[model samples]
Target: MEELTAKKDFTDIYTQESPYEYLKETRRLQYRIPDSTKPLYLSLAEQLYNKLHKPVNVLDLGSSYGINSALMKYNLTMSQLDDFFLKEKELTKEQARQFFQKK
Candidate 1:
């Protein structure tokens, strides 16, 4: 009723537009740099990995594009990911062919 209507605007994520809208739309990707916090997250993941042993798995709730999983599984760096998905490089036929060929 009136109480519910008077509640704060907690559901509106669009109140402040996203800064990485272009990256999200064009590349179908979302970016969130963990920066100094990466080590902490990695350390926690390592602990969990050790507890579970080989074939460690992680469930990143808000992970954009699951970059943390990639980092944990493949040891890929953020710089490498950035280089791999440069905005200037359009998807080519050969690239598309090779992508599907690997599997």
Candidate 2:
């Protein structure tokens, strides 16, 4: 069997001053695990909601920029998030607030 090894230590990336910059670097590196797993997380949340018959609180460990919370709460796909962050890169605080308020 072929062995897999990590090529880089991403500890430095985690220490970026801006979360957006970290996300941009991760995106550039094609780190799309969260995007791929979003469906599974959403399904699990749905199952929990169905079983509990109430709001389900999710704790996202190592949440970083709260991507999981934003994805679930806004019902957004990773592509949408990428577009928002990458394309609309200069949004002011109020604009971002209003944008998410619409979501």
What TM-score goes with each of the models? 0.47, 0.74
User: Model 1 misses residue 18 by how many Å?
Assistant: 16
> Which candidate's lDDT is highest?
2
Q: Predict model 1's lDDT versus the native.
A: 0.50
Error of 2 at 95 (Å): 2.7
Cα RMSD (angstroms) for every candidate in the order listed: 9.9, 3.8
Question: What shift in Å separates residue 28 of candidate 2 from its native position after superposition?
Answer: 0.8
Off by over 4 Å in 1: 1-32, 52-54, 87-89, 92-103
Per-residue accuracy of model 1 over 1-103 as CA lDDT, tens digit each: 1234453332342232331333333234333454445777788878887888875556876655555655555565554545444534465557534533443
lDDT agreement with native, every candidate:
0.50, 0.74
Question: What are the per-residue Cα lDDT tens digits for candidate 2 across 12-90?
Answer: 7678543556667666777777877888998999999999999889998886677788888898866677777666556
Q: Which residue window of length 10 is worst by lDDT in model 1? A: 13-22
